[model samples]
Target: MPQGPLFLARAVYRRRRLRDAARLLPVFGLLLLLLPAFGEQSGNLAHTAIYLFAVWALLILAACLLAPALSRSEAEGDPETDQGPQDMGDS
Candidate 1:
């Protein structure tokens, strides 16, 4: 029997996943921010502030870690490109 089709190379696969995560980061952050609203309304301003700060810090760290890999992938000339309109009237 023939083997299954080959999977994507590890680097490409990892970069694609990273791109996905980068795209989803904002939505993830929003959900995390909303998490406290779903919990008990303890009315403790300090604890809520701490949670918000922690979430903000985590999002920043995640972006920092992902930025390098994402930039490297772009520098490598990823196959997907935005093919804009070909006709621009002025030179």
Candidate 2:
């Protein structure tokens, strides 16, 4: 493989991953935000169903947030990329 396109490709991959992690990190915290609410158990089937739905909804939302993050890692090669400080200046 030629060097030029590879470097550009890598830089693009890095930026995409940065963008993706930027997006997901908040919603990931939000799913954690729901954890306390998930534990208030009552024996009603309707309530159980609602809880189930809510948990799944959060799971889906978190997954939606994560989809890009995961894909970025996949494209960028190796999910072991550096998670450096959040660049507040760029935000």
Candidate 3:
């Protein structure tokens, strides 16, 4: 049976490198939120907010589209390991 894209994404997020990359989403979001502060139009709070919001939304959309691909690349470069929780019952 063929696995769906969601299944592949779930598998990718299970990897350490991929998971680490995934954790950056919030950092990026915060940075994007602060972007208007660095702009020359800081005086125009409304325009700055709208511009920042649009850019941030686009960035988030791009990240969502790219995350799976990034994770897949990391998975390919690194060796696969057991992704499930450790079994403590043994030994």
Residue 31 miss distance in model 2 (angstroms): 15
Cα displacement (Å) at residue 74, model 2: 1.2
Tens digits of per-residue lDDT for model 3 on 1-91? 4343554454455565456656777787778788767767537778876878797888778688768877677657533343556566875
Which candidate comes out best when scored by lDDT? 1
> Which of candidates 2 and 3 is the stronger one according to TM-score?
3
Model 1 clashing-pair count: 0
lDDT of 1 by residue, 1-91 (tens): 4454388667767778988999999999999999999988876889999999999999999999999989998888544343556455755
Name the runs in model 2 displaced over 4 angstroms: 1-42, 79-91
User: How does each model score on lDDT?
Assistant: 0.85, 0.64, 0.67
Q: What tens-digit string does per-residue lDDT give for candidate 2 at 1-91?
A: 2233334566556666666776766676677656656766556768766766886787778668777766766676643245555555753
Please give the clash total of every predicted structure, in order. 0, 0, 0
The alpha-carbon lDDT assigned to residue 19 of candidate 3 equals: 62
Which of candidates 1 and 3 reaches a greater lDDT?
1
Clash number for model 3? 0
Estimated TM-score per prediction? Answer: 0.75, 0.40, 0.44
User: TM-score-based ranking, best first?
Assistant: 1, 3, 2
